[model samples]
Target chain A: MFFQILDILGTIAFAISGVLIALNKKMDPFGVLIIAFVTAVGGGSLRDVLIGIQPVSWMTNMTYVYVIFGATVFAVLFRNKLNYLRKSLFLFDTIGIGLYTVVGIEKGIVADLHPIICISLGTMTACFGGVIRDILCNEIPVIFRKEIYATACILGGLTYFLLREFMSDTNFVFVIAGIIVIVVRLLAVKFRISLPSLYKDKP
Target chain B: MFFQILDILGTIAFAISGVLIALNKKMDPFGVLIIAFVTAVGGGSLRDVLIGIQPVSWMTNMTYVYVIFGATVFAVLFRNKLNYLRKSLFLFDTIGIGLYTVVGIEKGIVADLHPIICISLGTMTACFGGVIRDILCNEIPVIFRKEIYATACILGGLTYFLLREFMSDTNFVFVIAGIIVIVVRLLAVKFRISLPSLYKDKP
Candidate 1:
């Protein structure tokens, strides 16, 4: 029940973020809605597909579709007021990634994948929605160029495996790992930490 | 047996195209190989996932991986000669889309999806490899902006259903539909046909 609530909140946060980006790009209403939908579900959908899950999670559950739709409409209606809520939105977004990363790791473990692959899946689940959004918007994925986004997920995934060696309580492990992801991202952003540039000089 | 051969050819074509684009972007060899791999299998992987096919075709079959790897190496080695082979490359790409679109439609039919959804699956399978490639390279998908690419796939998918109504031979229907996609693309390129711009003024 707690995870479900977090999932919904994550969906709302992702949908609103998508709305902000789409509106900034001057997309029409339909485009904005589509972007919001993809951003909310794209990462999880990708994870489900990779592991051979049928129909995907969102298709089986109507809650995500409704949440994304409601969030899109709400964000669009009060887009101007959103500037004031940036910090709140950022917090929600960070929490969303933390939850998503752990969720993905759990799914991978259930599928019996290797630990390395699980870590990759966790990072992908937390990051690929924004990647898809950036691709649609004709920009490089921000995670690929800057930000400690995927790195935090990777670290959290490592923490999950490392903590599991000594802990029998899976739920406790999940919470700690998720908290690690959230805390790492928060610290990274607060300190303005970013990935080092790949290029010798900016192209 | 025939479809297998065609699939390999398509993989090769897609991989080579990916290498070309990655080279143009001055990406490292590792990046180029990753792009080629995605461009070769990304579309079909997407289609399989949507329809709930387990392990996806590529994961179960190593043929695609080998073909893409070989194609990438061959394209990189003969980069200079690729210009002379542009027409040949274009032909292969057209054939690749033709095969991919039909393959996707067949998968959708097996899954008992609606005809409209099947058509969409076909278009996605035929075009999303390039979409992913473009995304990884940080550009708008060429198909979304211009090109009669997905249009050809959609028309071919329609042809598949339409022909199935009158024909008892499934192989014949596949051939005709694939030909339609190939022919439409060939004509579009020859005539420089494109989707009309959605924007009233250039942004």
Candidate 2:
């Protein structure tokens, strides 16, 4: 039940983020919708494809489509008012990534993939939507720019497996792992922590 | 025998294109290899996923991996000399997209999707590798701009269905359609034809 709510909320939050970017880019309405939809589901679709899941989760379920559509309308209509709720939206976006990481890890477990692959899947799911959004907006992906976003998901994925050894209940591990992701992301932002740039000076 | 040869040549051409872009971006060796691999197989993988084919085509076959690796090494080693062979490489790349459009349409037909959807799938397969390459290199996708590249693929896809009505042999349809794609693309480039920009100045 908790997971279900989180999933819908995440979809909405991500869609709104995409809409904001599209507006900033002065994209047409069709472009805005496309960006919003891709931002909401691109990561999950990529994960499904990588893990050999056919038809993908979203195509089978139409709720996400409706959520994205509604969120797109809401964001586009209230673009000017969005500044007032920026902080709240950011919180929801952070929470969405935390939940998304756990869900992606669970999907990887179901596929019986390796632990490292599972963690990578988790990070991809939690972050690739933003990557797609950035790509569509013609910017380098923030995740590739030393942001702590994907790293938080990786940490959460590791925490899930570590807790699995002592905890028999899956829900407990899921909740704790999600909390870990949220905490890591919050702390990283608070401390302005980031990865080092890979580019080096030629001379 | 024919199809296999086309596929390998296409892979080599796409990988080399990726290598050229990566070198231009001054990306490191690892980044160069990654871009090459993604450019060679990204389009087909996307088509497979959208049509519900699991694990994507490249993940199951190691041949693509080998081909991309070889192509990347060749391109990197001969970077300075590549200028001489640019025209030859362009021909191969054009042929690659021609074959790719037909392959993508066949996959869509096998899935029993709508004809329009199949055409879309065909165009996507022929163009999305470059889109992924541009995204990874941090730029607006060339296909989305004034390029006539995707339009040629769309025309090829339409030609496939048009030929299918009277043709009993699938291979004939495939070959004719592929040829149409190649011819259209070659002519467009030769004549310097391109789509007009959608963005316009406010009156």
Q: Which one is best on TM-score?
A: 1
Q: Which ten residues in a row have the lowest lDDT in candidate 2 chain A?
A: A194-203
lDDT of 1 by residue, B1-203 (tens): 97788878878899999999987786655556668988988898888876778666765565776788889889988888999989888898999999999988988988999999999999999899999889789877888877899999999999999999999999999999999999999999999987787889974
Error of 2 at B179 (Å): 1.7
TM-score per candidate, chains pooled: 0.62, 0.61
Candidate 2 TM-score to native: 0.61
Candidate 1 has which clashing residue pairs, if any?
Answer: none
Q: Model 1 - which docking category? A: incorrect
For model 2, residues A63-84, the per-residue Cα lDDT tens digits are: 8877898999899888889999
Q: State the displacement of the C-alpha of residue B185, model 2, in Å, after optimal TM-score superposition.
A: 1.4
lDDT of 2 by residue, B145-196 (tens): 5556888888999989988899899888889999999999999999998654
For residues A1-203, could you state the per-residue lDDT of candidate 1 as single tens digits? 98899878878998999999999999999999999988888898888888887688899999999899999999999999999999989988998999999989988898877776677678778888987898888876666555678889989999999999999998999999999999999999999986554345653
Off by over 4 Å in 2: A1-53, A57-131, A140-203, B201-203
